[model samples]
Target: MKAFWTLSASGELWQHLAISSWRALVGFAIGGSIGLILGLISGLSRWGERLLDTSIQMLRNVPHLALIPLVILWFGIDETAKIFLVSLGTLFPIYINTWHGDTQY
Candidate 1:
């Protein structure tokens, strides 16, 4: 607790917090945009739903942790990978919820 106070007083805590918050914000924006677009398509069009629903459902079933290695391999251990992983984690919930809300009669 004392160490936390020390870091906070020195602004290190704020810096780290800001970075994390920024990452989450960026990830959420990216994920939410894609989710919204896809959800609208799936909800509105029977052909679009047939095209996208299966793939999105499969993605929703896969755990984010299980994709860490693949994300790393594909994007390398950089900010991009971190953002992508965060986006992946954020994507499905928004997608699922939007789909449900938009599609259900």
Candidate 2:
């Protein structure tokens, strides 16, 4: 408990926290925007849905863990890789929810 408290009180903790928060927010924004746009298109146009829905659903089902090696190879173990993984994690749920919401009404 003492060590944990000491670590929490340190400047390094805050810096790490801020970086994590920034990554999360930026990733969410990118993923959410793309999901929303694609969802809207899919919901509004039958052709768009036919073209994209299957591909997206198929990609969504592929496990994130399975892609980590590829992501690392492509982006390396850097901030970009972290953010890309975060965004990819967020994209499917946002897309499915937005598509359902747009289409149900």
Candidate 3:
């Protein structure tokens, strides 16, 4: 529709996208840092892997969309909850990929 196209091209749309992109970038960084630390710890200590591997795998399979209601219930509709979800979403992918990539053949 013309109205949808006009709205999509508006300055407000770009601003909203930029804000969302920035949050994604921040989430990526936070998650990547956590993943990297976990990777290093796993590499450096078998005990760390023993402690963390199962829980990370369990968390990986959780449906993120389904978490919104619970996250909002637990954390409320605030910046902290939004960022927490973003961080969790970002963290899982990196951790799963790293674990898969680095594991033995």
Cα-based TM-score, every candidate: 0.91, 0.93, 0.76
Every model: Cα RMSD to truth: 1.2, 1.2, 2.5
lDDT of 3 by residue, 11-104 (tens): 5777777878887888778888898777656545678789888888787888999889999999998766877788887787677666666664
Off-target runs (Cα >4 Å) in candidate 1 are: none
What residue runs in model 2 are displaced by over 4 Å at the alpha carbon? 1-3
lDDT per residue, candidate 2, 18-77, as tens digits? Answer: 999999999999988888888888988889899999999999999999999999999999
What are the lDDT figures for the candidates, one per model? 0.87, 0.91, 0.77
- Would you list the rank order by lDDT, best first? 2, 1, 3
Q: What is the C-alpha lDDT profile of model 1 across 1-105, one tens digit per residue?
A: 998999999989989999999999998899888888888888888898899999999988888889889998999998899989778777777877877888787
Candidate whose TM-score is highest: 2
Candidate 3 — worst ten consecutive residues by lDDT sum? Answer: 96-105
Clashes of 2: 0
Evaluated at residue 76, the lDDT of candidate 3 is 93
The C-alpha local distance difference test score for the whole of candidate 2 amounts to 0.91
